[model samples]
Target: MRSEDALANIDVAVLAGGLGTRIRGVLGDTPKVLAPIAGRAFLGHLLDYLSAYGSRRVVLCLGHLADRVTAWLARGDSAGTIDVVCQIEPRPLGTAGALGYVRKELRSGTVLVMNGDTFLDADLRAFVASHRLSGAEASVLCVTVDDASRFGRVEIGPDSRIRRFLEKAPGSGTINAGVYLFSAAFVDRFIAAGAVSLEADVLETLPPGTLNAHIAKARFLDIGTPESLAAAASVIAGRES
Candidate 1:
């Protein structure tokens, strides 16, 4: 399928189940995903960007203050014409586990996975195309950042295979932007494994050739910390999807 066509058909799973330990002080009772940036919920901005995909299906994997997040989603202010639904986790289910919880709802096709707390403006069309071309079970959106110390770095081999996943340290490297494209079969295996982190378990254990990397220097932001959240408003202000 073409990139835009794939995006429209793909099921988008936004991981919003994280407990905002770092930002809870700033946001109080509000879930981290609902933290406002530039006069809108951070999720609003995310959905705005995702609107470009012309996708009408979005599944929010919700935890920690799920009720509040559900209430906000109920207001119907964030998703525009998209159909946004929440899959509340009974308990903390890590990354893969959360996805597993909602596996039944996912259609048979590629699924686009994104981090709710981080925003990386990678080209979806190109990313999806790369995944389709690679014939890998999963593909990661990698970004060449000046400093990779803040995040775990991903090393790409000559064939765009993920060769090494390096630990965080002060330096430069290409890092996973926390966006992924996965085939339905891959997701089924992940869900069957149960209670695993998408990165630490699935990605880390997969063969290098199974995970392709598409590197791009996209506009990015991580609102996991107070410092980043404070900077979000300025960074995202007046930006259009």
Candidate 2:
């Protein structure tokens, strides 16, 4: 699909509600996504990347220091073109549950779900294309890492359907990159169910073929920890240059 078409047809929901507890030792009051990197708020780079690719609409699912996140958005940080909406959570909700909280703000037939604390540098358009081509209710972006021990293993069928998700253990295999595409019908059903974890409650329980995979060789970063956040400047700089 053309870039403009993709922009109009897809809406992005960024799950940024996490409390930044892991890196609180270092960042203190900062929301994870707002963590400083390359002399700018991390969310700015995220928005820039998405906006560069014609992602016009983005909904931020907020929790923890949600007010800070909304304040950041209120600035000119959207970088224009990309429109952003921040939905704050009164209570801590799991990943899927967070989306359920802001189900009303989602507007596209296809909503691209992104983990707030992580960044997967890949083609969002291709991810969307794969989901539609597979004709699945939900599709996850999977990557084969050198070591999946930290994230656990993902066993996918030969047909690109997700077979199983393993626990965090020593292994090198395909893993969910924390990016997903969800169909409207599935989103409505999932939200209606209420208060579900995306991994344990949703994907893990879905039928084999209903949840599909879009595997990509992408650069992944989780800046939720101090070590990763410290190293992020170099990682992001490399991408920029």
Clashes of each: 0, 1
Q: Give candidate 1's error at residue 33 in angstroms.
A: 0.7
* Model 1: how far residue 160 lies from native, Å: 0.8
What residue pairs clash in candidate 1, if any at all? none
Tens-digit per-residue lDDT, 1-241, candidate 1: 5434647877899999998999889999988888988888988988877877667788999988999988887788886777887899999989999899998878848999999999877778888889989998899999987777899998788999998798998977789999999999999987887747999988988866779999976867889999989988876773563
Model 2: per-residue Cα lDDT over 1-241, one tens digit each: 7654565668899999887778999988988999989999999999887886788889999988888888887777756887888888889888989898888899888888999788767877787788889988899998887767768577888899988887887757788999889888998887787746988888888776668888887877889778778888887887788
Compared with the true structure, the alpha-carbon lDDT of candidate 2 equals 0.84
Off by over 4 Å in 2: 3-5
Q: lDDT per prediction?
A: 0.86, 0.84
